[model samples]
Target: MICDQLNDGYDLVEPQAPAMLESLRAFGYNIQTAIADLIDNSISAGAKNVWLLFYWDGSESYVSIMDDGKGMTEEELVNAMRLGSRNPLDEREPNDLGRFGLGLKTASFSQCRRLTVCTKTVNQNSVTRRWDLDYVSQTREWRLLRSAALNSEDRLSCLDKVQSGTVVLWEGMDRLVGETKTDDSKTHKRFLEIIEDVENHLAMVFHRFLGRKNNLQIWINDRLVKPWDPFLTNEKATQWLPEENLYFREDKVVIQPYVLPHHSKVDQLTYEQAAGANGWNAQQGFYVYRNQRMLVAGDWLGLGLQRDEHCKLARIQVDLPNSMDSDWSIDVKKSRARPPAFLREDFKRIAKLTRGRATDIYRYRGKVIARKSSASYLFTWLKKVKHGKVFYVINPDHPLVKEALNIPIEYREVIKALLRLIEETVPVQQIWLDSAESLDKQSQPFEGEPSREMIEVMSQVYKALIKSGLSIIEARKRLTTMEPFQYFEELVNRLGE
Candidate 1:
């Protein structure tokens, strides 16, 4: 359908080298994600071990990531350094984590002005290539340096010990350590803190790889990094919901929801650790992964669900294949993902189920504790329906209700009327909205009261039953069956003592 005249008139206008390269640096990658991009290449090259070393010298600081992966040759290294070397539309290998083939260059330039890559293949000579932004700016052309900057030979020596591997060196860290002196302890401390941040990010993003047995290893500054499993699947009390497979076209997305146990079910230290890096409240939602590499963590994905406290323990794992990258809208930085329109409804349905289970766990933690005992269940308020209208009725058989009924006949009618009025004026809709807004603000039955208050009430019911000619054993048994008191088995045990 091309017109001959228009096709012949079109002129060739290439992007200015300096301007495009500078613009490529603004891909919104922080220190952690930039390093992760390099690691992705190592993994694709079949590296089992990856080591990250950060040497702090303030503005002179340098960071290098070395991996024992299949290294590229001299010519391959040059092409890898080229921008847009691989097309996003090209079909990649099954294990390839890259899409646009721009991660190594863009990720490096985002953090530093100097990027040097040293690599060697099996029984082959080592080759090194450098991309200096300053030099490129001066020349205004596509240029690759033959050697790394002076004094970096020692740092690059570590790669020589291995048979075949690649080492990515980042220097002239303008964004990270600009113009700070080596003696500045404050800046030095801040640089060290960034290392900690990077460590945490890797632990989360590559948790699947780190947790695999003999799969992959990542170390930061000689310390082994452990994977942080969001599901807490190892705990005995963690609820593993049924796994589901959702399909769209030819691709399949696997989803598994987990409802973590309440704090009472686990030790204090485990509970604190389970809160994750962002704490429990912020860490609740779907975790989207592509090729076992996490892209979106602790996100609701605009699924019309708020991060409510009651559902904080809910975490769902979603697995996506790399082939669906464009469909999911995965960004180059690998920090964001959006489900395609066709799959949003399915995601919402699964989210609702998981949140329901988590809310049940949060609200009924006491009920779970009570299940261990053989005591009969009791509730002070009974739900009743009459003439198709639903409402609550106070249980007349409850110990407190019986005691109030035993008052002088003159007051019994007034007491009954007051209970009826309370039922009629129940703020159902208001309470529902308030609970949705802030579940933490809702109080549990007899919450925060002194233990003595519960004990006193238990004692009153125990004595009343005993006066009616019941033995001590029968009185204690009756107390165990009483409403509210059933939730406090220990206080019920202390009765009549």
Candidate 2:
């Protein structure tokens, strides 16, 4: 038996230049995100320490990142300079820093036209590769150039004397320099300012790693980067949720919920740390981090359910193990992350409870003053009934009180005097009787009879007390116990005579 043979033909297509690299300069991708991508590559290269050095001449400036990592061979260095060469699905060492290979090339090209990567292995001679935008534009090709034997000395002279490491230099920053300014002095000042801004960005992006004793140390110029933790440390303020452990196959995910301190407990430093770094802005819910890297910095799937006024004070930190990356759908930029459908429900449940607690605290604060004032008045009234030493209530001056009322505490004297007048001249009974007459609008009334209008007025006065902050049940009990209505009935009989 003869088997039928099938022939498959392949067609060739012309090579095209990548638009992403060119678009970087055109679109002004020199912001924080692009800079962060550059650092991420350095960290992934097994660098235990990285230094970002900026040199600003009157009108020209360059930025360099030097790291002490496992340097690559001449062949490896060439591949490293190529764009999109690293496969995301390729298995890497457990401690490898990068999965996507586009980070270094794209990140560097986004900032400058010239990207020079120089490396030296522990026992091997150093090698260098250069990717020049001008060269690419002229040749219409992405070419990686290695140093020749004669140029090796010259190339090695430009690099630092590190035993085993790599240095990434970004030069010919025409886009960054922009059009010539008025004078060299003005241009130099602007250059310095840009460097400082870049330093701030790096400090925040690598804050967790920089702060760790075992993790890498990153420095800008000569200044050591300090980590800024979003969670404020206040002894008075803490929200600890029960520790929750969820298992997915062999992976263990820990969900620890935290309630931030009350607004009053947070100082300026604490408030800024919480509000600025932690994304504590309204509706800015949970912050999720993977491998100590912030993936989803704020909110859960944009639910918008956490927009309560008190929730502005809430922040929950969710720690996800690296194994959960597939479950989280972490993006290449690391700017957005999402939990799997199954895990989202659990997160939403925790978020709801945390936000509810914050709202309760906010509501309690709103009523605190009224409740305290009423309690003081009740205490004073009780003292009078017992015929004990007359105790005066002293109002404490507090910010909460100031926010609630515009009047000064000195007005307390005038308010007390008015209360005394009502207590002596009107009496609870007479006031009720007068209110009854006004409500009925009757001229020819029975001379000595108790009227239904008087009873209604007394009921209304009790409601007013309840509305003033007392519980309705409590106000009713107080009104009956005081016998204010009974006293008003007696006054009506006397007035008729």
Candidate 3:
């Protein structure tokens, strides 16, 4: 509290512990995020391995996170359990992931009613502290217990195995598991699912830490959590755009844009895995990180750009230091971030370039048409801008269209009028709505079904090319370069046959 000139005039007001703890639970932390907040503290303590244990006894279910980091002493554990323990404005160590110092308390309270932290340091006796919300509510005081809850000492046995470490145990998980039977299988499945959610969320949020060879290891019930890299960097098909660096008040912000491989380039399993937990479309946008920990994943950052299917491949990585927390409006939850005005301008430019490149790769089969061959990429519907308004027309020079035009001159006008009618009523608005609403539902040319229809269409195009004074080899080559057919290499090979 800042001192006033008339300090004696201020009231001796303090918040009620029960009400304050309840309010702290409303920090918008889900189980996964709250757990990640705790892991941030463990990482700050230089933990190489963090173990999470979930014990299921229905209503008595609890979650424990133990880290092999430098543990806190009795004094440190007491202060760490206090609400708003450290000032957010204080200078922290370079790799510290904490701000406001409320994570250890707030994150625990968000998931459970009883928050117990047992810690040990090298050559020092172990210390335990408990903050039972029920006790605090009944007592109506800031009573921080110096001992663990009765019979809960065994849960902190992992601390005994390590010379120095911290074990944060959460009991009375009212938010996660409410009053229920101890032997209910249905609820047990839900408990397992919650554990899975924690695993996946941790895998993504701390992917940078978990990705390295021997960096950080997070285990849930002895099952190791692997990093889920949004940018599939190992795949040769993924396009890594030029990295750009921006600075705000002399603080470095590195930006790297990645356009993931098209679905055709990779196998089905790899493609599905790369889609991420939210699928491909929802997982497309700027992934913001602070201190190598992901803060915001797959957001456009209010750059006025909608998540379009063509731009689904564009995912930009923006890394920032904790010093820019205020500049980015980083929340205590660490789940959201907004760019400063200066950085927003730069983000807009980069988004446009990345989105444009992604659109090209998405539409053009991820191949540079000019460099690939002499044949230009085909667009079934060509955009023409004659007047101020824009419109699309079918390319009449296409082989199929040309073949129809070579029908009798008498029926040529009929074909022309039919083409005009089809072009005029192209369902542009409907197509946009379908693509925007359900991108996966929208089918490409002969998408799911067998390629019998495709082969038949290719045969017609092949015959037309042959009729236009082209040899069998030339006609087959022409079909290979055509749209839709280019993707079917085997079908293109058997075009003339």
Candidate 4:
């Protein structure tokens, strides 16, 4: 072995180009959310105005997102398109939209296999870059192609309407096209729907910035995207936090917890707006943002509460400074964020309050109409029943009794005779026993000992049955049949007890 080592030199094999496409696919994981991340980049790049243009031509449909941000130079454009080119450890400038330089290439490639970027700076001539999957597969390499030098007329033509801006065109949209009917007509309709979806998502994701005067203006197919603020503002009132809590460590972060209005207090429009603003539908929890860029919209972080209607009503806004970005476990897409263990206690406290308030509003119908006092009907019934007054003393004046006692004069007279017998006796039990004995003598059936209340209510029920066309005995039987006689007997026992 020593002799062989003396003669042999180590042969080094080059490392394979580290599965570039596979790594990108993994890094660009969330297709639905990744689109939002790209739009965030466009916004963060200081793009005042952006447009999502859709072109449909059977299997050749494409999407172009053009923005008026500061366009990159030739070298910068090359680096921007390169995968994992930006150093994650390097501190970013305040307001920079990109962290890992992977956003442009990865996000674009995640949606479409081919991506072309065109940009023009103020003084320098315009540059174009294209990344085609077919070209990559053929060469087994990731190539950044520079356009032929722009001649005087070509530069004028290229710079014509683009005035210091960047245009990102995505073609070969295989993933988006999918298996849907690729017919021109169907594709156009589908493209419109996708544009609408993009518009809606961007509006919500950038709602804060969109609300500002100089905010980002996003347009899809000539139609401007309106930023939808989830925090509903209407004539009713704004839902505000019970208190604003600020936390500090090495970085400054603010946690504002809001208690939404009771469900009944908001109209459908306002409620829907609130729900949308707070990511209320099925996802509810903390909305964490870094440098005004949303990292996670609605998540409970394994808290017991799952996203549901109750949580949707809650809105907690967490603002984190750039220093704590790594501590929060923020992903490249800026779609996921996690608070540090130390910060979680504070977040959980705020989350608990927000969730509790939302649950209260959902269950108790909000603070506005919460039970200020007990139900009136139960109180009234208790008051009347406690007194020794004849049940009819309270009944005849009551709405339910009045409605039940529509009877003929003859039947009314008979009921009056029974009441007169009760009025004559000081002990009502003796009078009731005597009335039962008299009813038995007259061949009428008496079910049990009748309390004054039972007699009065029964009289009304009997008369109502008779007026509806039964005879005296038939009406009495029908009234008893209306509800269990034992139920009335139980009521009498309860009153005595």
Candidate 5:
């Protein structure tokens, strides 16, 4: 594998500039992520305030990100605009939010055909550099434009207000606004929507930075953006599980699980706000952060776990040092990460525990579950783990299950088969998607508007308990402890009154 043996025989070949630059635009950056990549550079440059201005001129619309960071020199600005400004293998500063070093060019080109950067130092005048895809295509060379495309002066004016900072302008936005005319209202609305998405993304990704008092401030068209805290840690009802630190090659990964309060516990607005960008179900999994910057949000990291309504409140925070980026397979877009094989077992264990706690809160209607249940309290369904896989089994000891089993021998098989089918064919993935789409629409057990049906069922269960040789008081108490009945404590108290 040594390079010394083949160095003399190697041939010098370089990639074609025009083709290479065009291909760089295919790195799969959406408007939100592309904007985030540019913000990372602003943060790395030690910016106190970052402003994103969206100018809508229909087909002529442009977007610019200006930051009061330590602006680079003219030579450094040109290098920063290069495709590969820094080696990925080289050790980066602890605070540097970049790797592969192509975020500026690649992210810009992914959204627009033209990219321009104007920077200034405290002691020097401003300087500008640009990359125009049209110029590159026409000349078929690695050409860096000395002047920006349209509205360059107005775009650079943002930096003039600050002593030293950098401003990134995106013009020729073919991928975004396209060829729509200035009077196109539909396209203008879509453009504003994109700006809103960028604002939300920046609020979440740079939340840790924005939360700090006097650290960093982000503005969208001059309006301040508030940080979106995923864990709702400030809420009094939020359950902060024990934090665990796992090791991978001498580096530490901090894992902290949080269980949000049930809807009944929190007000409707607070509960809705805590759902995050993708809603409660999609935002239930692990949130991976690197150097306080979020990389992967609400993902299971390929672990064998499905997002379920019963566990939607469980969100885990995973903090990884930048040094372990390669081990975690951090992508250039910084939107995905895969846990190492050795760490998957640990993640699975933590996930199981958190999911169990969340289910308890969900099923018990915001009440804390007891570690040990009373013998008289019956469970209709039980979870069984076999061969490291989970399966739900109907409890034969339950009054209804036992009564159903007392039917004719031939009917018993049919009942058992039906229960098995229901357990095995649980619509896990569908439930996850439905919960994400409208969590409030997914009703809790017997939570519908008609209370008569639930009352009748509860009365029937009470009668069954009474037939099993339980005293009236004992039956009533047991009914209060049962699954869905536990939530309807007042109804259980008035049963048979």
Candidate 6:
């Protein structure tokens, strides 16, 4: 009775239908993510196949997404169409992607004005419901129409072909093709490009689902989408690190770290394709998946890590159940994820290890030499730090540098001055930018040069070692352990005594 009296004292300050519905348009959904949100509904509904149609008809252009999922009836369709139909706190089925429940309304309103859903279920007749924004704004009432607008019925006809399925139609696409004419070739081209963007986005986000044979198939204008695996699992040189599991409140977070193969290890075609939509550098880091559906692709999750060129090969996979959505701070758009405070340190540790291995592969892969024997892969330039600032200096201990420094005292000063000038003028900025932009295309030392060029230099170093009281066998053995010569063992061994 006291609670009832307290409730009765409150004023009825319901939100205005016009303002409330219009506000949903700012949920930050582009065409790619909007369509993806609807597909999440299809997948949760147990859809096997989903088809997207991008029709161009000037101002009458419309897009429709039809799925062969177990369809909802009149009552269920009405509730699903309502904004915030289900509480976000409610526990959903293991495979269901129905969090927030505003994905349908917010995602659709972000792109179009008319949202119609026509669905059919077993033992139930086909039912249709439409939400026209114009009508709601005009009447200042929440009025969901009984069906799609006239002449737009043909778009919903796809639902008729399936025994139990649903078709979502998006008309009045002012946000996408505003006043675009059917004969305008430019608009047609832009429309086609948007379709391609949507295809690419879907290919990545739903790659795990699309990879399985019996899982799901998504089609855009009848063209099947192929999954773009980030890790290049099929490549022989790709490294698959051991997976670790972290438990949080009985929720298991599985982390699988991967070091993608260097561009030189794979074929040209494979190398280019594996660069992905944002190139190799931007595609590094953790790929967070919720219930086998990828959420954030290639992000550090605010772990204070930079996507440097050397770490481009490092890609980690994080698998989380939908139950941990709140823990990860998954946004409505599902593009961002922040690890909980308790798990941030664990994530940072794993990132450091993965990036370390990637840096080795990006440089000379020194660890590989260490594993083989006591030999070390020597670098020509040593990166130095002075007063917390970075600078590059020529490696003094390098065989070639040692040979030059071992010259007669009369010319030694001139050689030292020349080396200092060259070292000081090393084009660090240009080289860094060049490597950053085209690291994969950057050539290795003497990559395609003739063997004789390398042999001439190796002979100088070989002669110096012999002059220092080392035998020819010992000299050649030392040369075999040196880089650029380690790659040419036969040539190193052939040096005459």
RMSD of each: 11.9, 15.5, 12.9, 17.1, 13.2, 13.5
Let me know the TM-score candidate 5 reaches against the reference structure.
0.75
Question: Candidate 6: lDDT of 182?
Answer: 90
User: 1-497 in candidate 5: lDDT tens per residue?
Assistant: 35754676566678888889889989999999999998889999999999999999988889999999999999999999888899988887877889888899889999998899999999899999998888989998888988776556777887889989999999999999999999999999999898889888988998999999999999999899999998887776777766779987788999988888887778898888888888999999899998999998888888999989899999999999888878899888889889998899888877877887799776665343451344444577875655534456788787767766778989999999998898889775565445544534667788755388888888888888888888887777787667778777787777768
Clashing pairs in 1: none
Off by over 4 Å in 2: 1-8, 18-20, 23-30, 147-161, 181-197, 233-236, 277-279, 304-308, 369-497
TM-scores for all candidates: the values are 0.76, 0.66, 0.76, 0.66, 0.75, 0.77
Task: Name the lDDT of candidate 1.
Answer: 0.85
Residue-level lDDT of model 3, residues 318-426, one tens digit each, is 9999998899999888999999988886788778777876897855765544327546666667766443344789998898899989978889999999999998998
Which regions of candidate 5 deviate over 4 angstroms? 1-8, 366-479, 482-497
Candidate 6, 1-497: lDDT as tens digits: 68977889666798999999999999999999999999999999899999999998877899999999999989999998999899999998888886898999999999999999999887678899999999999999989999789998888888778888899999999998888789988888889999999999999999999999999999999999999898888776777765778999889999989888887689999988888889988999999998888888898989999999999999999999989889888888877788999999888878887887699785566444553653465666876655534567888877778788887998999988888898899886676445544446867666765467777888998887787777888777777666667777777788873
Residue 444's lDDT in candidate 2: 35
lDDT of each: 0.85, 0.61, 0.86, 0.62, 0.84, 0.86
Q: Comparing 2 and 4 by lDDT, which wins?
A: 4
Find the 10 residues in a row with the least total lDDT in model 3.
Answer: 431-440
96-169 per-residue lDDT for model 4 (tens digits): 65677677777887887767877777777777877777666677765665652223123224334656777777
lDDT of 3 at 279: 85
Worst lDDT 10-window in candidate 6: 366-375
lDDT: worst 10-residue window of model 2: 376-385
* Residue 153 in candidate 5, Cα distance off native in Å: 1.8
lDDT-better candidate, 5 vs 6: 6
Query: What's the C-alpha lDDT at position 448 in model 4?
Result: 53
| Candidate topping TM-score | 6
User: Which residue pairs collide in model 5, if any?
Assistant: none
What TM-score does model 3 achieve against the real structure? 0.76
